[model samples]
Target: MKLDESALAATTNDLTREVDARGVADLIEFRMDQADDPLEQLAAYDGELPIIATNRARWFGGKASDTGRLDDLFSASRYDAVEFVDIELETVRAKEWLAHEFRENDVQLIISHHDFEETPDRDVLDAIIEQCAEFGDVAKVAVFPQNQGDTLTLLEAVNDATNRGIDVAGISMGEIGSHTRVIGHLYGSKLGYAPLLADDNDYAPGQIPLEKLASLIELTKNERVDGQVIDTIRSEVSVPKELTLSD
Candidate 1:
């Protein structure tokens, strides 16, 4: 199914789990780097879900090496099931022409950035999203947040870019930042990646169980929070405490 806007994708290295992921996941993130004969699997795929193909390289906290990486992703782009393909922002910036190559295949490109160490300050984060937006159909970033404050920084950056009409997605990794997985969309993250099954190993840190995430997404959508409130939370001090009134 084609997404009009944002999507909640089930992340998997195995395509066989697609059937199990149907009810909760809106799309499949086929991890080429972690799977065996990924192209072969894609060729044989009969699943109903559209795919967001990813072949994450090792330097960016994944298993795949750099050898022939772009070639394989380009090949993945040819498959009918692939609606989107993810490539690193660094790679795209250096090669420059690769974005044109992917779009020519009729698939959107999601230019991604990963900060395994720490979340950068807000200005840098916004800059990263802007840079990704300039070349990609969507700008995606994943950062390791040391505290809740860092998650807010990421959400603000995402919201700032999104409010500018840029399609963007962001996630904060590790325990302290897991809450971002559920709420980042409310702040303008255009994609949510959770495992196909609760028991499946997470491709990234702090991923909630798929079913739980779906439920929370449902629950959170009803909140009466406004854009101005979120902007206030980001800018002014004690916003959270002030909002926390006594029942």
Candidate 2:
């Protein structure tokens, strides 16, 4: 559940199929919003991987449209199997008490922001990370990049956040930025997500199958045996401050 290390999560709405991801994924991202019976699925879950519950909202490119999305998310957090909960950055900014609710329950939170259209300016993305770090355990940003330039901007933003000592998860969605999913961890993204299978539903664009993503991680880990890429990024990026988790 540590936000400082790289972890891969398989995205799925079917809790029963999570067992297939046992070796491929470090965790399971239960997309509650996408399920027909989210709470029932959670209650019946008996899987090996810890769950990261996400009741995504329609505004954030998800199917959930009800007013009680947060209510459902909080309900899921009470489950012992759920180690983390993902809340949209907008929701956190709008609801002042949500952060406290999660903290009181001792549940780890991932404050997330998603740009389904296109990647924003590097500074804008950095600001989003700053806001996310102020509220949640891990600051997660996902943007749809149109080109390599956009993808680089997303990476730079993550680097900037990491330099500031913010625990972050950054990714550039869509095919143009697909490579970022595999390499973003090197630049300080702590988490990556992919579908359980290639034929299975993808929660986001450019998400590789869990099996393929695992292979890429292994390949990269071996190639970067000295961990020089991460070390170099840390050395070059200025650390203005360390992110302090709320007590």
Looking at model 2, report the run of 10 residues with the lowest lDDT sum: 194-203
CA shift at 75, candidate 1, in angstroms?
A: 0.6
Q: What would you estimate as the lDDT of candidate 2? A: 0.89
Residue-by-residue lDDT tens digits, candidate 2, 160-210: 788889999999999998899999989988999988884366689888888
TM-scores of the models, in the order given: 0.88, 0.88
lDDT of each: 0.88, 0.89
Candidate 1 residue pairs in clash (backbone atoms < 3 Å): none
Q: Candidate 1, 65: how far from true, in Å?
A: 1.7
Clashing pairs in 2: none
